[model samples]
Target chain A: MTKLIRLRFMFAIFCLFVSHNSQAQTKEFYLTLENHVFTPSELKIPANKKVKLIIFNKDKVAEEFDSFDLNREKVLFPKRKSTIFIGPLKPGNYEYFGEYYPNSARGVIIVEVNYVN
Target chain B: MLINTVILFIKDLLPIFVLLCLVSTCITPNRVPHEKLVYVCFSSVVGIFAKFYYLPMMGELFDGMGIEVIKTLELVLVYFCLLIGCSSLLTQNMIAAHQSNLTIVGLVIFTVINASEFIIFLDSYLANSQSIRDVVAGLSIGLGICLSFSALLYFSLHWFIKKEFFTLLYVVWALFLSGQISQVVNLLQQVDIIKSSGALWDSTKLVKDSSEYGHLLKTLFGYEAGPSLEFIMLYTASLLLFIVTFFIKSSKKQHYDIDRV
Candidate 1:
């Protein structure tokens, strides 16, 4: 009974540690597309970390989020939201655009390393 | 706005137009019947509507991988069909009929590709119908440019064929087709469907890909500023495939003729 209690105690501590690590590693950000244009146009994020991007498309037509630099592309439909996970990037400026409305829907992601303790 | 539309239209449409002209000229129509053209046209209309109807559903397929995979498959299939069709044109052999059928299939696939973009553009236009003047002007200018270009290209190829420069025509077709095949490789890499070792070189400083001349060269000759090792390999292989097939088919025809005599 004593041995079983010790194992259970270790398991509980390990689960807590894993959850804390995952919470620290992943970052979430939100963006909006309206009238075939990105709301912010430019987004800043911490470099070398995974990011979850939630995009809300409020337009009447679909638009593709294409970024050659980030090597990512996703189609966003009208009146819908999309979740894209992008990650572990080096510090740089990555440009993205809507394939259909290349002239209008453009945005940039600026990734920078965070030096704060 | 009109000028921008023209440029955009040219960038999207010129490559396909060039491909059609080169394929039509290279085929010589003797072995491949003209009746296939009507079938190809009919299939194009079907392809357009099918793509329009299915595009939204296409996005969610195969866990969001359906679109890229389907597009890549279509591109590769078209490339294969084009190769076989061009090969059959080298001689009126037994394979010519079957290969012509394959070419028709290729044309249908290309129609799907072409129509997808056009429908998307139309949808955008409809949504922004308030800018009707800009849309009409832009489309007209773009159409005019494409029409003039197609006319010039057709006549030029006709002149070359008239001069019996079949080999020159073959060379151009080989180069253009090779470039096109390489684009499939790039697309495959883009979607992470194919793995590449990254680009081998960078030439963007000398000639930006967005420049007019750059666009022309790309459309005419499949130029790339940064090509990966796999891309170069695929490009060279496809180019060799075109030339080898052409020569092999021509020699076989000569052998058959000599036997008959």
Candidate 2:
């Protein structure tokens, strides 16, 4: 009976730690597009960790989010929200551009170890 | 604006011109019959119309995977048709009459892809009307470049064919096809449709893919600054498959000829 109670206590502590770790790990970032330009031309993110990116197209025209570095491309319709998951990446810079507006719309992601924490 | 527009025009149209030049050189005559040409043109127009009308619907299909999936399918189909058309020429083991139709199918699919870009560019320009003149001038220049470059390709390929450099032509053709096949891998990776093991090497500093020469090389042979392991493997595999199949078919034909003799 004593052993069973000890095991339950340990399990409860383990669950709490896991929940806290998950909450600490996921980071959210936002980007906005307007007039064929990214609001933040560059974004900084933590290396070796998955990130949730939410992009808002504030423009009247659609834009394609293309990153040859990250190997990701998605169409962002006008006045729509796009959610993308990026990384667990190595520390480096990943450049992206708006395929439709390659010249004016460009940005980079600078990934560094422990940049956020 | 004019320069930018011109560059964009060439960038968008060059693929079409290159494909046409290569395909035309693969066969004997430089021109197809008028009726067949009209049919192919009509099909391309239909493709453009279909793309414009269905863009929104296609975007939302398959939970936002519709476009990638559809484009990948179209590209794969085009590659196969090209393989059949070109391989038949090299091996002479298939019905020559049907080869023309296969090449036409490849042409139509490629036109659809290339024309969609034009449609997209036009729509963008129409949305912002200030750059109309720049766009028009740029398009004209782009057309000029395309025509000249394609003519160069046509003449060179013809010269090679005339010289009976079948081996050289076959090797180049195999590499070109492999490059195209590699693009299917790229597209699949782009949309997260497939995962790559990451880049194997970075050659961007040595040869940036966006440079003029880089673009030319890319079109002629799928060149990438940083290529993934999957890409290298796929390119080699596809090239080997084409070369081996060509030789196998040719040997079979020779054996048949010997028996008849």
| Lowest-sum lDDT 10-residue window in model 2 chain B | B188-197
True contacts kept of each: 0.15, 0.02
Model 1, docking class: incorrect
DockQ of each: 0.11, 0.08
lDDT, residue A9, model 2: 100
lDDT by residue for model 2 (B181-241), tens: 7876666554444443557888889888767876677777888888877689889888888
Misplaced by over 4 Å in model 1 are A1-31, A44-56, A66-75, A80-91, A99-104, A111-117, B28-31, B92-95
Clashing pairs in 1: none
**Where does candidate 2 stray beyond 4 Å?**
A1-29, A49-54, A71-75, A81-88, B28-34, B92-95
Give the CA lDDT, 0 to 100, for residue B39 in model 2: 88
